[model samples]
Target: MPLAVYLLGLAIFVQGTSEFMLSGLLPDIAADLGVTIPEAGLLTSAFALGMVIGGPPLAVATLRWSRRRALVWFLAVFAAVHVVGALTTSYELLLVTRVVSAVANAGFWAVAAATAIGMVAPDAKARAMSVVVGGITVACVAGVPGGAVLGQLWGWRSAFWAVAVLSVLTLAFLVRVPAGRGQAATGLRGELRVLANRRLWVAFATIALAEAAMFGVFTYLAPLATGTAGLPASWVPGLLVLFGAGSVLGITVGGRIADARPYQTLFAGLTALTLACAALAVLADSGPALIALVFLIGLLGFGINPAMSSRAFYLGAAAPTLVGASVTSAFNVGNMLGPWLGGVTIGAGLGFGSVAWIGAALAAAAIATVALALTLRGRQPVPAQARA
Candidate 1:
C-alpha cells in the first residue's frame, strides 16, 4: 500500500470519530439544547438519513472531479459544519448541521473508498479496504469514549471542536492522493447503466443484511453485558474495548483471505457470526460464557466487511464510485434498521438475550442471500460484459 492509502484511512478516522461521537454527546446536547434525549437521538438518525439520501447524488455530481479534490472539498465542508454545530445553541439548527455535515461526510466516504482501491493493486483491495474500514472500529474503541470524556471535562461542544481540528489535520495529507486523468469523466453513461443489473442489487442487499446482523446485537450490547452477563455497569466500557479489539482482529483476518476467496470468506464469516449469536442467545445468563461470546460476536460480526465490500466491487466494476456510495448507504440503512428490529423484539417481551437470536437470524438471512446469488450465477447466463 502507498502512503496515500494510509492517509485515506486517517481521513476515515477523523470522519468516523465525528460520525459516531454524537452518540456519546447526546445527553449533554439534550440537556443544553432543552430537548429530550430521544429528540437528541434524532440527530444521529438524521445523520444516517443524510448519508443514505446524499451519497449517490454526490457521487454523480462529482464524477468529473478528481478524487483528491473531491476528498479535500468534502472534508473542508465537514470541518466547517462541525464548527457551526459547536457554536449553535438551537436544537433545530444543530439538527440541520448534523444532516449537512453528514452529506459532506457521505461524499467523502464515497470518494475515499474508490480512491483507496484505485491506489492499490487489484489483489490488495481487500487488505487496503480493511485498513480503511478499520478506522471505524478504532473510533468505537477510542474516539467515542474520548469524545465522552471531552464532553464531561469541557462541554459537548468541545467534542465537536476536537473533531473539526482532526478533520483539518487530516486534510493536510490530501496532497499525497494521486491525481486522475478523467477516468471517472469517461464513464458517465456506462456507469449509470450498471444500475440495471439484478446481480448488483443483490450484492447491495447482501451488504445491508450483513450489517443489520451485526448492529442488531451490537446496539444492545451494553444492556446485554449488564443484565444478562451480570457484569458491573463500569464493565460496559471494558466490554466495548473488548468488542473493538475483536473487530480489529476480524478485519485483519478477513482482509488476508477475501480477495482470492470472496464467497468462501463470506460463508466463513457469517457462519461464525451465526454461531456466536446463537451461543449468546442460549447461554447469556452464564457470566463466563457471555463474556466469551461477546468477544467472538464482535470478532465474527465485523469480520465480513472485506468479503462484502470486495463482492460489491466485483459486481459494480463498471461504476466503482457508485458501488462505494452504495456500500455506505447500505451500511447506514442497516445501522438504523438493525437497532429498530432489535427494539421491536425486546418490546414484544423477548429479553435482551433475544437480540442475539434476532441477530443470528439476520446473519442466516445474509448467508441465504449469498447462496441465492451463487445459485443465480450458476442458473442464469452471465451478461456478455460480465462474462468478459
Candidate 2:
C-alpha cells in the first residue's frame, strides 16, 4: 500500500475511535453528566445526526478543493473538537462537541475514498480503499477496546484525549498529499439529478436498513454483556476484540470480491446478519454462544461494506463523490435509527434481547429490499456506464 493510503487509514482510525468509543463510555458519561442511560445513548444518535445532516452539503461545498486539503481541514477540526469535548464538564456542551466532531468526521469520510482513488493506480483503488477501511476495523479491534480500558482506568475523557493525539499525528503524516488536483466544481443540479434514479434510492435504503439491524443490537452491547449474558464488565473489551477480528476478515474478503459480485455479497451478508441476530436473541444467555454469535455478527454486519459501497457507486456513477456522500449520510441515518429503535424497545419493557429480535426483523426487511431490487434489476437493463 502507498504511504498516503496508510496515513489515510490512520486518520480514519482517529475519527472512528472517537465515534465508536462512546458505546464503551456510556455508563461513565451517564453518571458524570447526570443523565439517564438513554439520554447518554442519544449522544451516539446525535453524532450520527450530524453526519446525516452534514455529509452531502459538505461534499458539495468542498467539491472543487483538493481532496488532501479538504481532508486536512476536516481532521484539524475533528482534533480541535475532541479537545473541547475532553475539557467540557457540561453535558450539553459535550453533545455540541459530538455533533461538531461528526460534521468533521462526515466530511472526512465523504472525501476519503476519492482521495485514496486519486493517490493510487487504477487497479489498486479497491485494495487501497480496503486498507483505509481496515483502519476502521483495526480501530474496532484495538482503539475502542483500548478506549474502554482507558475509561476504566483513568476516565472517559482520556479516550477523547487519546483520539486527539492520534489526530495530530495523522495530520503530520498527511503533509505528503498534493495541494492541487485541478478538480472543477460540479453543478449542483447535475449532482442532484443522480438522486432521481429509483434504483439508487433502493440501494440507499438497503444500506440504511441493513446497518440499522447491526447497530440496533450493537449500541446496547455493554448492557447485554453485563445484564443478559452475565459477563463481567471487564470482559467487554475482549468481546470487542473478537468482533473486530471478525470485521477485519469480513471486510477483507468483501473487498476482494465486491467488484465482481456486489449483489451476491450483499445478499449473503444480510442473510448471515439475520441469522446471527436471531441466534443472539435466543442464545444470549449462554456464555460461549454469545461470544461466538458476537463474532459472527460482526463478520456478517461489516462483510459487505465494500460491495455495498461499490453497488451504490455503480448505481450512481454519474456522481461518484455525491454518491459517496449520500451513502455516508445513509449509513449514519441507520446508525441513529438503530440506537433510537433499541432504546425504544428497552423503554417499552421489551428487554435487551428484544433488541436483537428487532434487528433480525430489520435485516430480514433489508433482504426483502434486496430481493425487490434484484427483481427490478432483472426486468430493467443495466446502464452502459454502470456496467463499465
Candidate 3:
C-alpha cells in the first residue's frame, strides 16, 4: 500500500463507471435515437467491440512508452471519449465517441494490470491487482445505480457528462502515480511470438470461456430478474446491489485463493461456477431459490477473474506485456460474445433463464481447458502456501 495504489483504484473506478453505466441509460438512449430497446443495447456492444479490437494492438503499439506516460496518455484519451459522448447529439456521432472511449478502455486496462503488478512486491501482486479491480465492483455497487439516477434526473446525456468530469479528475490525480518502462511488445510480431506457446492459448481459452459465461448472464440480468423472477422492474437496481455484494466477497476470497495456487484455484472456481450457473438457470421459478442461486452464481462466477488473469501472467513469463494485453483482449472478446449470444438466444424465443445455461456451459469449458493445462505442465505439486 503505497499512496499510488489509491490512485490506481480511482483510475479504475472512473473506467468502470464509464463502461457499465450504459445498462441503466439504455432506455433514454433508445428513446432519443428511436431504436428498439434491443437495438439500443448496441451501445454496450459498440464499447465492448472497441475494447476487443483495440486492447492487444494498443498494448503492442504503446509498449515503448514509460508506464506513467502511457497511463496518463491513455486516461487523457479515455476522458476525451467521455467528453465527446456527453456532448454528441446525433446517435451516429455518439457511436463514434463510444468507439473512441473503447480504445482508451482497451489500452488502460492492459497497462493497468501490468502497472499494478509492477508497483508491488512479487508476493503482493495478487492483492494489488485485486485492489485495482475493485473499481469494477465499485461500479456495480455505485456507478450503475448512480448513473441510472443521474440519467433519470438530468437526462442520460448528463450521465456521460458526469463521467467526463470524473475522468478529467482521474487524469489530474494520476500525476502522482510512479512512472516506469513497460515491456516492449514490439508489435503484432511480438504479440504473435508469445502466442506461439500452446499453453498460452489454453490460458486464453480459459479466460474467454470464463468471461463468456459470466457476461452472458450478466448482460441480460435486468430483464431476466424482472421477467423470470416475477420481480418489479424497480427492484432490478436493488438486486444488482446484491450482485455487487456477492462479487465483492467472491473477488476477495478468490484473490486469496489465487495467491495459494493460481491455476488450481482457476480449476475449482470454474467448476463451482458451472454448477452454480446450472442450478440457477434450472431453478429460476422459485423466488427464494432464484435469489439464492443468482447470488451464488455471482459469487462463484466472479471469483475466478484474478486467478485466470494471474495464470496468463505466469504462462506468458516470456512476454509479460503481450500476455497482459492478450488477457484483457480475451476478456473483452468474451464480453462482446456473451451478450450477443444471449441476445440471439432470446430473440430466437429462448427464455431469459437460458442466460444461466450459457454461463454454465462456458464455465465448464473453461474448467476443462485449465485442467488440461495443469496436466501438460507436469510440474511437481508444491504445498499451497509455497505456491503463493
Candidate 4:
C-alpha cells in the first residue's frame, strides 16, 4: 500500500473522531447550552442528516477539482467549523456548526475514498479501503474514549478544540497525497449514468442492510448489557472497548481477503453476523455470553465492510468520486434506520433482547440481498477496464 493511503486513513481518523465523540459530550453540552439532553442529541442527528444528504451534491460541485484541492478545502472547512463550534455559546449556532462540519466531513470522505482507490491496483482496492476504514475503526477504539476522557477532565468544548487541532495536523499531512489519477473523463451526465446500473444499486442495498443489522444492536448495547445481561455500569465501557477491538481485528483480516473473494466474504461475514445476533437474543441473560456475543458481533459485522465498500468502487468504476458519495450516503441511511427501528421496538415494550432479534432479521435480509447482488453480478457482463 502507498504511504499516501495511510495518510488518507489518518485524515479519516480525525474526521471520524469528531463524528463519534459527540455521544460522550452531549450531557455536558446540554447543561452548558441550557438545552434538554434530547435536544442536544439532535446535534448528532443533524450531523447524520447532513452526511446522508451532503455527499453527492458536494461530490458534483467539486467534481472537476483536483482530489488534493477538494480534500484540503474540505479539511479546512471541517477545522474552521469545529473551532466555531468550540467557541459558540448559542445552541443554534453550535447546531449549525455541527451540520456544516458534517457536510465537510462527508465531502472529505468521498474524495478520500476515490483518491485511495485511484492510488492502488484494482486487485488491491479492498486492502486500500481497509486502510481508510481502519482510521475510523481506530477512532472508535481510541479517539472516542480519549475525547470522552478529555471532556470529563475539562469542558466539552475542549474536545472540540482537540478535534480542530487534529484536523489541522491531518490537513498538513494531506499535502503529500498525490493529485489523483483516472478521474471520470466524461462530464457530469456521463458520471450520473453509472447510477442507472442495477448491480450498483444492489451493492448499495447490501451495504445499507448490513450496516443496519450491525447498528440496530449496537445502538442499544448499553441497555442490553446493564439491564438484560446484569453487567454493572462500569462494564459497559469495557464492553464497548472490546467491541471496538474486535472491529479492528475484523477490518484488518477482511481487507486482506475481500478483493480476492468479494461475494464469499460478504456471505460468510453476514451469515456469521446473523448467527451472532441470534445467539445474543437467546443468551442475553448470561453476562459472559453477552460479552462474548458483543465482541463476536463487532467482528463479524465490521468484517464485511471492506467488501461492501469495494463493491461500490468496482461496480461504479466509471464514476469513482460520485460512487464514493453514494457509499457515504448509503452508510448514513443505515446508521439512521437501525437506531430508529431499534428505538421503535424498545418503545413498543419489546425487551432489550428484541434489538438483537431485530439485528438478526436485518442481517438475514442483508444475506438475501447479497445473494441477489451476486446473481445479478453474474448475469451482467464485466466491463473490460474492470477485467484489467
TM-scores of all predicted structures: 0.95, 0.92, 0.93, 0.98
Candidate number of the best lDDT: 4
lDDT tens per residue, model 2, 1-388? 6678778888988888888888889999999989999899878878888999888888888877778789899999999999999998899999999999999898888788666655665345456667777788998998888898899999999999999998998898888865644235446777787778888888899889988998888777878899999999888778888889998998888778776677788888899899999999998788888899888888888887777766777777666667778888988888877877888999999889889998999999999988989988988787665766
| Candidate 4 weakest lDDT stretch, 10 residues | 179-188
Which residue ranges in model 4 land beyond 4 Å of their true spot?
Answer: 181-184
Error of 4 at 260 (Å): 0.9
lDDT of 3 by residue, 11-107 (tens): 8888888888888899899898788897777778788888888877888878788878888888888878777777877788888888888888878
Global fold similarity of model 3 (TM-score): 0.93
Pairing residues by index, what is the TM-score of model 2?
A: 0.92
**Please, what are the lDDT tens digits per residue for candidate 1 over residues 1-388?**
7888888888888888888787678889999999999999999889989988889889888888888889999999999999999998989999999999999888888888888877777788888888889888888788888888999999999999999999998888888888653246547687778777777777788888888888888888878988878888888777777888888898889888888898898888898898888888999888788778778877887788988887777667667777788889988888888888899989999899998888888889889989988988887676553333
Taking the tens digit of each residue's C-alpha lDDT, what string does model 4 give over 277-319? 9999999889999989988888888889999999889888888
Better of 1 and 4 by TM-score: 4
* Model 1 TM-score, all chains together: 0.95
Counting only residues 3 or more apart in sequence or on different chains, how many pairs clash (N, Cα, C under 3 Å) in candidate 2? 0
Look at candidate 4 and tell me the lDDT of residue 292: 91
User: What's each prediction's clash count?
Assistant: 0, 0, 0, 0
Give the whole-model CA lDDT for all candidates, comma-separated.
Answer: 0.84, 0.83, 0.79, 0.90
